[model samples]
Target: MIEWLATFLTSSPKPDLLRLVAVPVFAWAAYRDVRTRRVPNRTWLPLALLGIALLAWDIYRASTGAMIGGLAERERFYLRVALSLGMVGSLGYLFYWFGGFGGADAKALIVLAVLFPTFPAYMFPNTALPLTRTTVGVFSLTILSNTVLVGAVYPLFVTLRNALSGHRAPIMFIGKPIRAADAVREYGSLLQTPEGFSRGGLDLDALRMYLRWRGVTLAAVREDPERYRDPTSLPDDPAPPGDGSIPDGGDVVGPETTDATASGGDEAARAADSTVADPADHATDAEAAGADADGYDDPWGAEAFLDDIEGSAYGTTAEGLREGLNVLAAEDVVWISPGMPFIVPMFVALVVSLVYGDLFFELVTLLV
Candidate 1:
């Protein structure tokens, strides 16, 4: 039985043998990464050692001009593999710098560098074409498998991870447009769009996407810090009292509150308060004041809400302030990214770079 098993194994192709050895390793690394959001150095350290060992062996063969393991020139092979690994490392850094992947992720890439060759090593120098039709067929099948898995598996994994995170983040939501109060979708966190906000560094698109025009003044507090400081409109925060640059006893009402309170007494006083207002928040405040002036009801207190939310709103209005801010918080409608998808600590691209060289990229890019 042992002789037969050895015979069967030796009879199998080298590419198949290599794959048989590699599949479990890649799978195990992926499993650890998914399970703990980390991959242990123990697993990768061996791989790094393997790379250094392979590199050394190749150096010996190249210097002697002898082929080992039936491969091509050792120097060419070593340089190619090292250069490919370097590319993978560079890609990982590019992603990490942009806020992708955790530290463990880059380490994993380094380890992977030792194992994968640029392009599939199965094809031989004997072949004249850079890629044979047979190779293309095999590559296509592999790519198809990977793409399908990513689409199906990753989302499920994210769902499972989020479920275990214990944060009770929202999963889905119905976006209802409200007029005046600060109605934000809780699940989206700070993931706002940059459409109109590129110029201001404010959250106008965030208001539109998450808050969605739902707003109401929670309070009518006359002495809001916002009034004296005008965070959004004023370029700088109020000078400390020691500087005396800040006016004494500045009215708390902003252009928003002033506009809402305009009918009460003086427009000049309202504008004179001269503070910046975020359109979404400002609209909510002015709407609250307008509603209060007209004897309407409120849910999220206007003064309290404004004091807490950061930044200014742009071009916000108050058509139906009372009804907008009434809906209570729910459990779904988006995902929370500490950073963002664009800024992840670990990404799948590194793995691809490890397995396939520039060819893999050119292939994926063409297909994608």
Candidate 2:
């Protein structure tokens, strides 16, 4: 079996097993990218390890004289593999670092380099394209270039589709409009205003958080202990008499005066001046005492600060539709980008290189 394997590896001149492994892996990546716009590490890591193991074994065989290929051929093969791996890895890192490609894309490219450092020898006779036959050393690079060429046509297709659908300019050329409701459900990003000039809408999420922090419910704003308190100005120690305010000096928001604190001296003086109070006035006095006890004078309470920055609908949250009401109407429009996943183009390029050779080579030939 070992002899047979050695003969196969030396005689074939290409990693046929690696090619077989790559087909399904690349296909899975294409599907994952299109559906989720992500390629998990699990998809590429195993394939990369397998390629590395195969290469290591080849090296071991060659060192021990178990490899059947001529010394020159083995050396050339190792050189090609090493060079291809380095070139592909460096390019992938550069692309990822520069934000030209996603991390998944970079990882997939490296895996491709490991798996197919050289083109499959079995394909040579059948490959009709001249570039495929000639450029066996840098198969991954050809795939990368081809992917770029083929991927360019997607935007054109999107533009044409939008034009035919009677969609307007700008976003129309980039991506077609789905119903705002549907768009919110989708993973795509909204291409519209982040927020409005007025208090457009409340983010229920922020409201909920504020409610939780304040320990208040929507049912009873008036009775909550934390209602009149400023969270940023809560004090640990009580204010001394005649001070009539917390140490922090944050006033309790109230209905009456903008400048808070009625003053303990004024309250004492008023109490002394009052001889008799009506039964109805007793309620007012008690309310005033309650306000004094809390050391807060704000009438509006924390509700005045409720105009918080709500979560945006355009980003990861998908909280609300941008211009959703108008978009719900038949005439209005909204724009969104259906995220472009890079793996689909990569898959196409792989197939093209296998069947018709490098796209750039063909283009050059046609031009010449």
Candidate 3:
């Protein structure tokens, strides 16, 4: 046992050590993604830098013939690393560009490529360390394949949960219904709207984030819905604080706005009149607001807040907020699809990759 432990600790090429270090980091990232649906860009920086440093050290050792197989092995190591980075790095960027991967997910994969361009080896008495590996042996690719395999089970779980709850629609396989009032506090997008069942409606989770970013709470918004809806009523506040900069006061209402509009002032009366407009005018207004003919308002200043942010970090747009708000305001119940946070499965894949190796490869080998 001591001998094995010493060998494990002193393993050459050292990627296994990095992998062990990454476990906790990946776990933290998954937690953040699950809770807030956002991971800070800085989260990947340390891992990326450490990966580069280790790669440099390995290359240096290989060049000096200190690597296990001398100069002959150096060329093979170079090829493997190049191929891994070229293939896996390109895939990660492409995934993000095509919207298949989030920015953080893509970054994680790219960093993994740099960290473990080739599989890191471990030894066990009864079993080989990696039960399966691909022909190319790109470790990041293995991780990605494992992630997909793990993520694939989520839909089945959703379906089973819905089935047990007596909701048997095809759409129920992807989402479930929750009270509209609770939508703000929940994690998902509205799957069913006033019109009908739709896959894309309002994202309640994003709404919650937007409100939190603005230093407010769902209860506060519910208390004075009309005040938040009126754009002109709000004070000229600066951009919403960045992530983790939530204002000192928790669950506090945002800056006070004029109550004139809520109290049936002239602007309020005009808004009321606009609601009764002819179909053509109503359609024009709805189009402008990016909502349907049914009344939609930015009750939490979501549109302005989204615009102020550099990018769609929360995976929502101003128009999307308006459309979602419209549904939340009008509906008693809304069907929502709580998106599966990919990071969670990615973390699981990391662990499985370290322990049991490539699950996809094993399955394919079994079938073949």
Residue-wise C-alpha lDDT for candidate 1, range 197-306, written one tens digit per residue? 11112222233321211111112211232331222322123211111011123222232343454233333433433333442454456454344453423222333233
lDDT of each: 0.36, 0.53, 0.68
TM-score of 2: 0.55
For residues 1-368, what per-residue lDDT tens digits would candidate 3 score against the true structure? 98677666665336566657888999999999887767899999999998888888878877888777856567778988997789888888999999888789899888888887877777554444666667767787788889999999998899899899888775888888777666655566777655678876766646655554554444434444554565533334542544422223322222332333224244443343232122233234555644445554554466667766666645666766766766776666778896888899999998899777788888988999
RMSD to native, candidate 1: 15.4
Best by TM-score: 3
In model 2, which residue pairs have backbone atoms overlapping below 3 Å?
A: 252-297, 252-298, 253-298, 253-299, 253-300, 254-298, 254-299
Better of 2 and 3 by TM-score: 3
Candidate 1 achieves a global lDDT of 0.36
Deviation (Å) of 353 in candidate 1 = 11
> How much RMSD separates candidate 3 from the native structure?
6.8
Residue-level lDDT of model 2, residues 139-177, one tens digit each, is 777788888998898888989888887876766655667
Residue 359 lDDT in candidate 2: 75
Which residue runs of candidate 3 sit more than 4 Å off their true CA positions? 11-15, 69-76, 125-128, 209-318
Error of 3 at 173 (Å): 2.0
TM-score (all chains, Cα) for each model:
0.37, 0.55, 0.75
Model 2's C-alpha root-mean-square deviation from the true structure amounts to 16.5
